[model samples]
Target chain A: MPTAKKSYSTGAFWFVAPAMIVLLVVGIIPLLFALWTSFQQFILPKVHFKGAFAGIWPIFDAPFVWLSNYRDLLFDESFRDALGRSFLFLIINLPIQVILGLIIALLLHRPGHEWLKNVTRIALVIPMATTFAVVGLIGRLLFNGDFGINNYFWNLFFGHKMEWLADPNLAFVSISIMDCWQWTPFCALVLFSSLTMVPIEIEEAAKLETDRWWHILRKVQLPFLLPGITAILILRTADILKMFDVVFIMTRGGPGAATELISIYIQRIGFRSFEQGMASAQAIVLLIITIILSRLYIRFIYREV
Target chain B: MIRLIRRLALSATCLALTAGIAGAWTLEEAAKPYKGTQISVIFLDRPGYRAIMKMLPDFEKRTGIKVNYEIVPYESTLEKEVRDFSSNGDLTVALVDLVWIGTFADSDYIVSIDDLKKQFPNIFDPNYELSDFFPLLLNAFGTWNGTVYGPPFDNYSGLLFYNKKMLKDAGFDKPPDTWDDLLKVFAPKLTQNGKFAYALQSRRGETQSCDSFMRFIWPWGGSLLDAKFKSNLLSQQSQEGLNFRQQLIKYMPPGIVDFDHIEAVNALAQGQVAMITEWSAFYSTLADPKSSKIVDDLGVAPEPKGPAGRKPALGGFSLAVAKQANDNQKAASWLFIQWATSKDTAKEYVENGGVSGRQSTYKDPELVKKYPFIEPMVESWQQGVPEFRPRFAEWPQLSEIVAEVGTNMMIGSTSIKQGSEEIGKRVEDVLSKAGYYDGKKKLAQ
Candidate 1:
């Protein structure tokens, strides 16, 4: 308001421009190109058109199909089925991960207990550090119908075996377990750091005033842990919503679309089918849906934070 | 009398297994022009491919072409090939799946070696004979619409591999010849005490289509597409085949729906399963000292015949010279292709654990003795279904739809009638959208 500064050529602007340019090239450009490609019948090496506006710039050079692909996506049963399975995976996985994480954090949040504090913390992080491919392979081996450790132990304990990847429901539960197992540590570590920041003196005061553990937990610990819980909820929701690798490797979204996540379905459409136009439309729609859903989640969780 | 003759034949086989081929390849004089040339290829990480790598030192020495090869897993290898082909990447020689032949030929992504023979005379080895390859194998893997696109490499026809000792213990001295004999005779006796009689690769991907579902369809008189290019999945023939598969599913492992080629093979190799109707290319894996426990007791036979005929599942790879490659690179690649697939090198290739498309390799006295799978594999290759999974550009999408429906049936979630109808409708819709099947012309031919 004081004065309109002409700082376009300033050193600060120049230094930041490189980062902006890189972001524009890597992220924004592909996104915009994807949007453009969404409206075109652009199956490479065979079907294409030099777009109306692309001749001059080369960016707009695909035959526009005008939302037909989007219309097709709306009625696509497999896409809807994938979206449903993705939500189911999240519904079953996120809560267990968060709750388990919170329990682990609370147990490890001791001030003087170095063994509980350090070793358990290191052990919890190992799963998160492992790649999903390895995690999926490990999950498959463990859950194998014959000679699998899960089956072996399960038979001894329960007197029956579960077809982990054969039946649809079991496959869904198996993949969710794998996903939850890998991500629980991420939630736990993130919450544990936040738990550590809660003043011990305040906890001591609450504990002295209220002799009951539940009363102290309800009156003091919960309020203190709210921010951490909300953070875990928001992050875990975002991550579990787009889970791909474990589901892809373990079952390949199979045994009849049991574990077909949104990302896996997109891979099927884009890479396997090579229906670029249809895939792009599906992707754009999925991105919008995920954004809205995540925002709503964040809004609900962050209401009183 | 048949037993006595068989014993004598077995003795001859034992004697035949002792010797090795001496003059396998003669390349130096012809390959002088391409000396020190470098070319790259991407191959599936199969036992046959590992064998190729082992023989590379000899190949490099003989041809003087520095071969730079990368081995990728089968699942991701398809995606990589498509990505490379679509992007027009600088690939000198590319490994192509059989199903991609039509697309590659149509898109001109790969050179038509037969067509190019006219353009570049004297490219192949002077005595390089195309007739050496089994006609069906060469046609199914390399040729598209009568135009040869690539030369066959690591060809496979689905063959039955069984545990001989297990079958004998069950009181059957021989493998089943018909689908009826398999279920009625062998499977019941063998499937007992935490063991499975057979395993079918009903996984919801390429294996289901290329190896399992499609293999059974035609043998029972079913066809994926009729002469009109319309899906004939719901035809009476298809129902018979699918219903038979449903009945046979009983003797298989509980998680057969989750089994792919690798899992099925592993099950057989571990002796958890007694038999596998698997690809001939996996013969090495089953016989490998490290991988297989039943190496000494494996028996090979052509896939059991159905009502129509014995049409084993045909699937293989081809070494296509990338048209995107430069002239020198293309010429150098041609030399490698010739050397790798030549009739002279076929026996050596088989000796090194590589599957050869050459009929001579399968017919070789020593190679046949060393690998029992060779004889029946050759028989299966001759009748290998050309359109087992449909060789076309739109085939990837078509096959996916087929796999999905087939898997649904495997899980018992969908009836054969429902699954077949879904396949027919979906395939027709895809074909229609692709401008195939105009009302009058049919596009079937």
Candidate 2:
């Protein structure tokens, strides 16, 4: 109660200093640098590593071209398109990922299907374990318009082969499908772990209150899984926001920028267009948007669905 | 100013130390001043780089200058190279794709070795037969704005690779000689039995712009930009090429919208496709018995001509000195560059199956006899399209526009007219922002 007398022990401070310093160097410095760079007109060198960092700090040498890059983005259709695409991608992907995860967790929680559960659980982890880049390649192959097994089956069943990555909406759908396939297991595994720990007595009590499964889930089971859901939400949200490699591999922001997302747009600006100033400005904007969305994401994950 | 003076003095010392040491100063003696000095060279992990890496020990032993070479995947090589260039590291020299010349030159990221040739005749070697290099290739791949930046490493001229057995089965004695012949006549015949006539690189990347799109343009009597540096994509000639490509898609492998060099070449290697217009450097992939089923039956020729002329797809790399490189490192880099690009080493380079840019290497009877693609590849390099890609600072954006629209067109997501219009408008936007329309600057040559 006496405020623990500000226990400034060298042991504790040293114990935590390395982690704190690492966080400062790796996390904060880059954020500050990005913020500073976002305000300036700096071209990452063509030979990107040669001379951009020659000075004490690149920000000191960068031109103070404030607000211009942001201003340009106001009228830039591509940036807007990317933002809209990213939002849509999240909207489509999040629900499917979450619902599928929950469903898998429930199925896996069944007591009698240990072999099926273990096999399926192993299968779920396998996709999550694979690199996203490899997944993108697999996605590309699976949806290949020419010889893709998906299209081959679609031709057989639907009497038509869909243009998966070439068509804009289809490309988005394909990426979303891959996203669901790759990430649902993550959400499911987390939720399933939480489900296992939900105390058997509580489920027994809920069952007495009501034999209805939905009633038990809504009243008893979901509350226990909220923390897991929220954790999954945070991780998935962060991962989805900056998602680059999979989309890059699957679509490269193309089929006429149909699947282009904010990350792709930023990359195009910084690397392809060599407009680092604009890209940084756009990134700062994206960062702000991401931070704002993080709160909503937390709230949404924590709330009753 | 003081730094410049010191560099000049150091260069003088380098020259004096390495100079006048009688005839044929051994690589060891020449590198005495730079002994133990480590120089870093970065390039993509291709067959050519493997050849150089294999010979690296010999260089190290002779010069006493340890060589550190890093090979990255081709897709990320540009980003990595640029990342290296932006950092003031020990990266002495970088191998640049031809498309990067404008960006590198505009940034002054590389030292213009052309200017240094006269200043350090000893280092450059006046007896060196500069003209022995294919002039078209020299200008296209290694030179920028009338100044040489690097020596050619891989001379990639697009060649028509055909499944000889497939063509023979299809009752064709030879590969098509022209675009009309290939598309109208041969493609349909060969496309029978589940074999495609060609697998063009229609993927939305550099190959899409530089390989497939540009390959068709010149031969169709088209170019990327007009005299005023406007988008020529909407030009009649350009449309002809685009239409030709749209038509060719039917005969090409399905899902061509996703095919890059690897897929296109693989389709040929797997014998799923009858033919492909792939880079000469990929010759090894097609010839590898392990990867290719038709290795023995592979036929090669220059890209088929169009109404205007034979405009070969020009894509390759050159080894250029980084501007941030120290004097001794530069000297050693020049030495390694020369040795790797020299006629004698080139013979070995070709014999080992790395496509050497030197005309001599291509004309070597033994090499030609060994590699059937050499003669046609040489011809293709001779008539290569330097402006097939605009080679401008704005090229990346413009090329993206073209690739996006072109791929959409190929995939039936966008009409030829719509694709052409979109490409023209987007390119105009990029150029206009760069003030190309207002005459603030000329489009990069």
Candidate 3:
């Protein structure tokens, strides 16, 4: 018996060892290096962390100057307007993605719907496979103020062309529409996979009793799908905060800093400006904000097991 | 049977040993061949790259150094260079942009070519007349204190490009000489059919901070930093310059704040703008029938004088030896750089679309007859003032002041007065934080 137990331990160790090695090399080491770098005035190749010990000075000093960076962001009416715009985008886009996904999933789960299910699933997931740059470029052409399809339609319908990406009010909405168009299918796929796990007997019992489809969905199916919906929201929110390649490729935080997000602002400081230390400080702040928001989402939405 | 098998195996082993020896000998011969060692040269995919490609086979035959070149896009080139530099490997050579010279110098990523002067005197021949190369082009960027950090590779001075057909139709036979003439004559001719009169990059990041603002600011007698490391972007001259730019915005494309270098280029090419302030490299683009509608009709002129006369900002690329490279690599790189920029080589390159820095190349009779803009461009480069990119460690932080405040002014979020003041305050904060504005240095009023 003791020999068998020893063999089992050895087997487990062999199975886990490769993964652990990979994690250490790719993730753990880099995380530690970045954390160490955040506190020092280190440039590439020449001044690595080994040469210097700047302690927590960057952390202390960063806040004093970064207060101004933050003040510029918070006090600028543009930022506040963008924040309000983001909220509007979330309110309009998020629920629709989840609900549409749920409906598609439910419809596809019907008995003997195999071909339809596979086709729908594949079609919905297509946008997820595209590169963000390609997506943004395509969006730009379709949303360009003068020659865009949207403006063409507006002119056809209302006798006047609308500058979709040029106007401050319309830019955020235009970006959100593109975002929703691209990501709604992803949400749908997640909920659909989760919906497949719903027990046939419980759903069958509910359907047998209730003549109304809406009643069955609200009372039985929605409660079952709550966890999937919460998971999608949390994942999407995390991504939305770091949303860069699309906005960067499309407008570059412009039409007068109208679409400038915190990520874009931090990047400009780091890469374009070359303030490696200040950029790190701003990055650390952004990381904190992201963590707090993620926590809030998890607490409010994923309360129960 | 056992004896026979052993004998066969021994024979096989002997054959394998002989093959290995032959392979190693061949490799040694290849490495030390008179045909010269093959070295990798990486450059950004600019017109100069094409020029180098045309001239490399001749260089290989003449110098016996086989050139292996990779021309990547600008973004990818920067990434690859930084990666190669950080990895501390032997890179033969790189065609680096002037803007990156400071960062490269600070990091000691590239080596100095001073020793090559003694080793290869003919190659570094004093009579090749490096002095005649526009001093701004020669030393405009990439130096740290007094050390010459890089050799100018592909060069262009910023020039004002106008559609000749459009300007002629507007009843102007010549390019605008003064700022007032530009606004009064060219602006109206340039503006028609809801299209802009002029297109200049105003997009709120590096372009706004560097090319566009510098174009206006210097000519209007404005400066970035005063003697005390205090920001003087709020000076009256700077405000006037920025205000004039704001007024220019009215005659520009509607989404002026979003325009970058490429967008401005495209607008002019597409006949959306009559005049554009752009790099001389755009001459190649303008001359390309496939790219520009106004190919034959494009007129090149020196950037106009304002309160200050014809202080065109110099924009160009340079070659630097990687500091981490071994001695052999350094020597080989210097040989390649010298050969590539030589008068004969440069003239051949200029004949093929390249805008070379050598005054001799521009004056080449064949080149002069073929490319009329070459002489005007040379004149422009002579008059051009290479922006003294502050070599201080805090340049990156200082640059942000230009981008942020400059961007704000473009969007009309701040008047030039307020924007320049904001720039001053922000720059002071940046300087103070960086320890440059410590008590010993008297603050600029």
Local distance difference test, per candidate? 0.80, 0.80, 0.69
| lDDT tens readout by residue for model 1, B190-309 | 999989899998888887776778877899999989887888888899888888888889899998888988889998999988899998878888888799999999888999999998
- Flag the better candidate by lDDT, 2 or 3: 2
Residue A20 in model 2: lDDT:
99
Tens digits of per-residue lDDT, candidate 3, B46-118, equal 7877878877777676667777777776644654676566555446675666667666766667776665565
Chain A TM-score of prediction number 3: 0.79
When sorted by TM-score, best at the front, the candidate numbers are 2, 1, 3
**TM-score, chain A, per candidate?**
0.88, 0.91, 0.79
lDDT of 2 by residue, A1-305 (tens): 87767767799999999999899878887777777877777766532332335343442356687788788889988789888888888888888899989988988886796778888878888989999899999998999887789999999999978878767788888988888889999999998998987789988888898878888888788888888888887777767878898999998877767778889878878887767778888888888887777788676667653
lDDT at position A233, candidate 1: 68
Point out where model 3 deviates above 4 Å: A1-8, A43-120, A158-169, A211-213, A273-296, A303-305, B1-42, B57-95, B118-128, B142-144, B388-393, B439-445
Return the number of clashes found in candidate 3: 2
Which wins on DockQ, candidate 1 or candidate 3? 1
TM-score: model 2 vs. ground truth: 0.92
Which pairs of residues clash in candidate 1, taking residues 3 or more apart in a chain or in different chains? A51-A61
Q: What range of 10 consecutive residues in model 2 chain B has the weakest lDDT sum?
A: B118-127
Q: Using DockQ as the measure, what is the rank order of every candidate, best first? A: 2, 1, 3
Residue-by-residue lDDT tens digits, candidate 3, A1-305:
55655345688989999999899878876566555545655344334222223532222112123244544444645335545544555667778777776777778766786887788778987888889988898888888765679879988999976656655557667777778878888888777777666688988999899889889878777776778877888787667766778877777666556677666666665565444454565566556766787788777876342
Q: Over the stretch A1-305, how does candidate 1's per-residue lDDT look in tens digits?
A: 87988566688888999999899878887787788878988675454233334322233234789998999989999899888877877777778988888777777775687875787878888998898889999998998988789999999999988888988889988888887788888878877877666688887887778888678667666766667777776677667666778888888878877777898888888877777788889889877876787677667655342
